[model samples]
Target: MFGSDDFKDQAVWEFSFRIDDGGFSWDYKFKPPLWKSVVGRTLSKNNDVLLLDASHDEPTDGREETSAVFQSRFLEGIGPIKGVIYGYHQGPEVLKATGNQTQLKNWLRDQTGVRVYRDNVRVFNYGEPSDDWLGLNVRRINRPGDRFGTNSLVAAISLDLESSYLLKEKTNREGFDGGGAFPRFVKLVLSAFERFEHVAIDDRKALDDVIRGKGTAVAPVRFLDAMDSLKAGVKSKNIPKAFQREIDAIEREYTELRDVMVSAGTAGLNLAVIFHEIEREVDALAAAVERKLDEQSIKKQIEQIHYMLHGFAPLLRKNPAKSIFCSEVIEQATRVRKSRFAFHSVVFSAPVLTKEEPDFKIKAAPNLLVGAIGNLLDNAMYWTKVRQELDASNGSRAIRVFDSAQGR
Candidate 1:
């Protein structure tokens, strides 16, 4: 009942049927035209065939209607079977219909209930094996020095029989018991199947060992492990946004510090000229204060001025690195900005180094460390001024600096 519209012109097939012993035999005559189509010309002899037992469970008490869809007709004493032959012409049209190898494989598995591996099939030219085997799971056996050219193509014969009484039926069959013709045919097919199964098992084992990094196969198991981790949702933290913010902050701080250093350099040069010209004047002013002023406050002011000038000198000088107490660094930075604190009326607090507390010391260039702290204080004072102008009632224009001891 094969028709061109049923399977398209790309379908080529053959089939056979037989009644009880010599009763009636039916087979498709492979005419000259079909024979011409069968030989792949440049290929080897291609009449390889496989036999499959398509047995399934008998219908249960309540599932008879559902199971009936898979049932086949009876062939007299040979049990129930619905015979069919189907094939696709291995041409561009077939490839277009199948789409790709993956789709072709899926279609095969859906129709045949078998898993196909890439190496399951091979073709052969004169005597050498190739990988050009066409559709219908045509697996080729590698036989060196075969004179069949490229006529070799593997095919399977699937017999759909009821599973519940399949063994009993086989034993009862006339030609199947006691090593008859049927037994020989069955044994030959079984042997072929056994060989194929062994090959499949070995192939699977090699693949498994390679995947686990336990064999000679040089697969990238570590890379596969990483891919597995990613599939399981192991993700790294997304820190670019936070990192960019920190970078921007550092850049802004650096720009301010550079501007401050440039201004200090100009002030330093002016101070040097003033120091030379006012050196004698400053001394005379201090002596006059000690001699005639007689006020302790005036004397302390003169000494403070001398101290401040020396402190400013180090800002432009090359101060060597040494272990300076953290308390001293904080005090030096605060001391330089003490007047600005008063001028802005901003409340400031700093840790008072006491005998009970351990003052931390850091090895650094004191001038650079003090300059960094000074820049921080400048930022705090600027923000504090802004807050006051934004809302006077808030009245929170304050800056506090503190250090912690390990135990405290």
Candidate 2:
């Protein structure tokens, strides 16, 4: 009954059966198996297990399923037993049988998926290393990015024998008979895993990107492209129109989310640049003080630094949409670049704003705007230095920033 081909592998598996005692009922006065009750008591408090009762209304009127329509109705009414599923790695502490940290870690490393329990007794070979009851390992090997392997989870499905009569165990005591309710049980379990994988994969990818310093920019683009490919592949198959519509909706949502991430990432990168710029200025200020520069010179430098920091106040505000004078933003950015320009022997030319233009304000995140300008200055300084080296006559390279109306 437990042939390799008979039972296909999956991330989630179902073990449905009823207790021998007729008194057991999920609705009222339901006595859970020792293992199930223990698990509910122990793991439920820690939120390790996600309990779902898929119990449906029992057929009131007894009707013989003689016709195909009646058979379909009967099948629809049949629901799995009330069971709880526990996902490992969903929390900080991994599930373990022993209290020893080393032993628990070893168990997590060695164990393969969830174990099965029937009437407080563990069903052997179900979650054993050699057992691939749900084909979790197989699916993981095929699609590593989206599937969880054997070591990643632990779960148990318990059912009473009297309530789950349709799920019959094989004569060899290996597994359930692969007939009638068995296939439906497998389908129900797989459906839950399918929903879980959707969210899990995104979280996994996001973490990986952060660790590798790749940022969130690449994921959305790749996801959208993959969706397009999947949509095309699904179109070739004889799938329903609703499936296509759902896919289209998902694609649209991903696109919007990608845009938001891109905008946020850009702002973050800008802020990083501004932070470095500030650090450089602070270091220079510290150096002048240590060198025991003249009091007047030191005071002037301190005032300049103060002015630069004062200009950054708008950028540091909590409300990013606050407006600031465009001229002031430009002046602050140019001030940050002054030391670099002088060190590189670059002749820098900045625009002179008239009285009328001084009042011109732009709605932008102050730090991001300054960071963008700083990056432009960095590029200009680099290219100017290159030009200076290439031409002996050009001892100093020039950078000019002017408004178009000025024609300078």
Candidate 3:
């Protein structure tokens, strides 16, 4: 029927359909169903229009006179039309013979309540200069703009039934009528599908779009809107599921960061414990060194160790934040690595200050300031060593500390 021009306006020989996926299955009364290509395309484009038997003519040269003798007697005994009626006509009798097709379509829509397709209306001229023949191909039974599985199924069933009847040479004279029951049933099914789609399909799609980074431009505002809805106690079916998904994603990120922080803190604590044990042993050794001044080299090494211990001990202790001079931080940091300076022969310099001069003071945890200075010295020492290794006579390897004399 779909391939033959004769059956294009008539009916098919047979129609049948079956859908199955193990858990669900349905079968419709159709055999040798319309070609898969034609039916699949029609189902996929549920709302596309197909116009048949249309004509194109030149516009009138001038305004035509309105006829006053038109009568409604021809329509007196006509019943309501149930089938689609193409606005196309034969010969030269079309009202707007020279009018644009689009305008003509609009005029027909206005006069007859027919919905003209706004997309994909193809015109074929057959490569000749004769009057143009136009045709629109579409599924005519669907309600405009409504798309759902059940709606499509209903449409398919209607088409199959109509095709079956037409094949039997049935016409309106046979009094074949589909009552109000099927229409009411269609309304109920469409209503249920709409509600389910709003919550499950549409909202879930929104969540997927934002998660895949496809909707980044709208994500911030969408989140804000969700928050506003929550705060106002307005219940929205769409937001809750998407909001939960986003929350789970964010929580996973922060959980990873928290785990990392915990591991780092544990490692720091273990290092501090090792340092404390060394400090205890060194203290006992220092007492023994105090008893022997004859061993000057060993005694001096012990003193340097003591200085380093003093510089770092504050870091482990529970020291409250307080006002302290910046110079003290620099001094302690340098003191901790005092032996390195001599071993490397690196010159260290700082401004000489008297008790009369005010030094720069900062209110912070003393250990923080010491740690900051220690990092700077570490970086400086590394590059200074690199420079000396590159060229020994470049100059003396040195580190200098600067500060405003007025404590700015």
TM-score (all chains, Cα) for each model: 0.28, 0.33, 0.30
TM-score of 1: 0.28
Give the winner by lDDT: 2 or 3: 2
lDDT of each: 0.41, 0.51, 0.38
Error of 2 at 184 (Å): 1.7
Better of 1 and 2 by TM-score: 2
**What are the C-alpha RMSDs, in order, of all predicted structures?**
38.5, 28.1, 35.4
- Residue-by-residue lDDT tens digits, candidate 3, 146-244: 222211121111123322221121144222222322222222222222322222333334333433456535535565465555545524445466666
Superposed Cα deviation of residue 206, candidate 3 (Å) = 26
Model 3, residue 9: what's the lDDT?
A: 23
lDDT of 1: 0.41
lDDT of 2 at 62: 40
What lDDT would candidate 2 get against the real structure? 0.51
